[model samples]
Structure formats: structure tokens, C-alpha cells
Target: MGALQGRIAWVTGAGSGIGQAAAIALAREGATVVLTGRRKEPLQQTAATIKDDGGKAVVRPGDLMKASVVGRIATDIEKAFGRLDILVNNAGLNITERSWRQLKPEGIDLVIEGNLSSAFYCATAVLPMMRRQKGGVLIHTASMAGRVVSPLSGTAYTAAKHAVVAMSHSLNMEECVNGIRSCVVCPGEVATPILDKRPVPVSKEDRAKMVQSEDCGDLIRYVACLPPHVCINEVHITPTWNRGYVAALQQAHVGAGKK
Candidate 1:
């Protein structure tokens, strides 16, 4: 039997990228996965892929930016599964504005609402169920920008990611006694669709050198499968190439006028 043979896991932003990969990975481990995203078609695609692999999955499409929708999702999960063993707060987005001077109020709100507020709403919504079970795992997909500022990631994105890390730590401190574990993953750069949102376009060659979504999926699966007694508080994953450090330099020198 798989390590998560009877577990129930819900992954937000499960349509594409890291979220989809993580949901599939958990299902592969025998968890009944719940896939949630803004788009129904992509969520259905993820669910179908899981079913194709002989794993169980279902799709729940909604706008996570709304606290009410997030609450409804938790309630729906409770009604359908009666229990949730894992919650992956993986929904997030960034804007093309890299600096505060270039950032607009609407852009900041979009980043904050999509990245930070959504995570907060989802975590709060599920905490009661997790506490009642007296054992569960919460995984937040923060960014390397959380640990340090990156010119590539905009100010709003960086601020929101930093808050995610802080929130994860706070959850651990407050809820570890309740048998709840919270882990924040800080990845430098991954070949996900989010890269397309960057202010400066990344070359295919550069993207190839970055970490892949599956790599993060594997890491999250490893973290989730550990014994209940073990709590991985935070993890920092970066590709061997460490492009976040060099991306700025490359844009200035190599990518100039390259389109």
C-alpha cells in the first residue's frame, strides 16, 4: 500500500504548474486528491490525468481570491470527504511590475489578494478540520523571493511571498501542539507558466536551466509522506544554475533587444 493510502489531500491552483504536479503526485501515493482552480477545464484535465493513472481525483473550480469561495470549498470538502489529511496552498500570481515606482495600486492588490490573502483564507478555513483530526499537513508554495528580494520578481510578489513564509512559521508555532504541521517551500525559479508573467521574458534556454514543476512536486510529496512526528518547517529549493542571481545580469547584457 502507498504511504498515503487513505489520505485526503486538497491542492489549490491545481490546473497547471506546481499545483497540478503536486496533486498528481499525492494521488500517485494513493491519496484521494481534490483539485481546485479558477478554470474548470484545466482542473478537469488534472483530474482526468489522475484517473488515467488509476488514482482518484476530483475537481473543484472557484475563484480563490474570495474568502467566501474558499470557505465554501472547505465546507464542501468536509461534506464530501469527512476529513482532510493534507492542504496544499499553492495558488499564487505575480505582475510584470518589478519596482515600487513601476507598481500600480491595482497590481499590488492583485498580487496580495492572489498570493497572500488566498493562502490565508484557505489555511484559516481548513484549520478547524485539521485541528479536529489532530493531525494534518499544510504546505505553502512560497517563492525564493520570500527569503530575499529578486529584481525579477516584483515588489508586490516579493512582499506577498515573504508574508507567506511568516504565516507558515506562525501556523507551526501555534498549531504544532494540535498535531498540525505547516511547511513553507521557497523555490528560486521553476519552469512554470508563471515565468511568462515576468517583466522581462525568459529565454527557453534559461527556463530549461531552472527547476521543473515536477521537481517541486516530488519534494512536496516527500515532505507530505514523512512520519507524523516529523515536521519540516521550511525548505529552500533552487536549481543548480541559480538563475535568480544571474537573471538580472543576463537581462542587462545578453537579453537586450533580443525579443
Candidate 2:
């Protein structure tokens, strides 16, 4: 149970959803977890719940879109724990208030800034320290939407997620030599507040197809628990219902090309 008895973990978006679940799971495995998000109450609540269960946790609420806060988060970790063993870049925001057409500038900024850039900032913040230590595990939450556009999510959300996938691949190639294990986790759907962050609520039928937050949370821990040499490059979680529509599209395109 204490596979990670001495590892230090930093989990963004821990106030809820996969981040929350991942934070608690890390603690369950014996890591001191730092929970970060925009709101303090939720972070505190998550920390409290973990502490109540005999897990060590801390909270650092900040706006990830701001580089300053991102730096602060890194500093906070350094101040509190000195070195980090695991990093879960699970914080993401989907701005569904307006369509891409309506939000050509503002919406683009919000989506890229919140989802993609935030992950970039956090990863960059930790890389130097991890490289110096000679080993660390970093997990970034992408999405099935990146695998293919979803009817339920916006274009910007999908683009930013795809960026995460690309970023992770690039980081894997860049940092593997330093004993850093990087992974991109693509989940189909989860019953998290992220759905509510949309302009409208997702239907019950769609929610049923979602992988639970706890499932993804445990998946994060599984990635974290892997042996130093065993690197899980990318883990994609999808409901059995997710037939490869993108594959079908490719097949159709080839058929058309022949015609």
C-alpha cells in the first residue's frame, strides 16, 4: 500500500475530478501531495479529506494562466518539500461560453492559456529539478477529444488537449535521457465538474459512457508506481462504446481518393 512511502507529489486541479482523485490516491500510496487549483476551499477540502484519512497534503490555490502563479506553485513545493518525485498536470479548463466563431481571439486565449499553456508552465517548472535528481514521473491529462473531436466538447478544448499530447511526446523525447518518465493520459469522458464547466450540462446518457474520476485517478497512480525503467508513454482510456470514428473517416477518405 505504501509503494510511494517517501515520494513527493504535486497535483494540479486537485480541488476536484481526476486531480482530486489522483491527489488522494498518491497520499494513499504514501506520498506527500500538494493540491493546487483556482479556489482555496476546494483545495482545503481535498487536503482535509486526505488528512482525515491519515494522508499528508498541502494546498496552493493560484491562477495557472499566470506565469507568476505557476512560478509560485513551484516555489511553494520547493519550500515545503524540497524535491518532487511525481508531478500530475491534471488541471484543465474548457471555456464553453461561446463558439469558436464568436471567440476567435478571447476564447482562443482562454482555452490555450488554461488548458495547454498551464500544463506547459507546470512541466517546465518541474523539469530542471527532476533532471537534477536523475529521475521523476510526470503525467499530463490529455483527452479522448484529442484522439478525435467530440460532439460534446468545443473545438478549442480539443485543440488544446491535442497540444498536450504533442507536448508530452516532445517532452518524452527531450527528457528520457535524464531518467524522467513522461506520460500522456487520454480519457474519453469522466463524471467531473469539467462537464458542468461547459455552457450547458451533459446529458445522463453521455455521462453514463464516461469513465469515473476515481478510475482515472487510480490510472495516474498506476503510472506513478511503474518501475523507474518501465515508462508508460501514453495511456488512453475509453468506454467500450468508443468505436474509432476517426478510423472510419480515414477509410472513407482513402476510398474517395481512389474514386
Best by TM-score: 1
> Tens digit of lDDT per residue, candidate 1, span 1-259?
7899999999999999999999999999999999999999999999999999999998999999999999999999999999999999999998777697898889889999999999999999999999999999999999989999856687888899999999999999999999999999999889999999877788999899999999999999999999999999999999999865576687787767775
Clashing pairs in 1: none
Among these predictions, the greatest lDDT belongs to 1
Task: State the C-alpha lDDT per candidate.
Answer: 0.93, 0.88
lDDT score, candidate 2? 0.88
Estimated TM-score for each candidate? 0.94, 0.90
Number of backbone-clashing residue pairs for each candidate, in the order shown: 0, 0
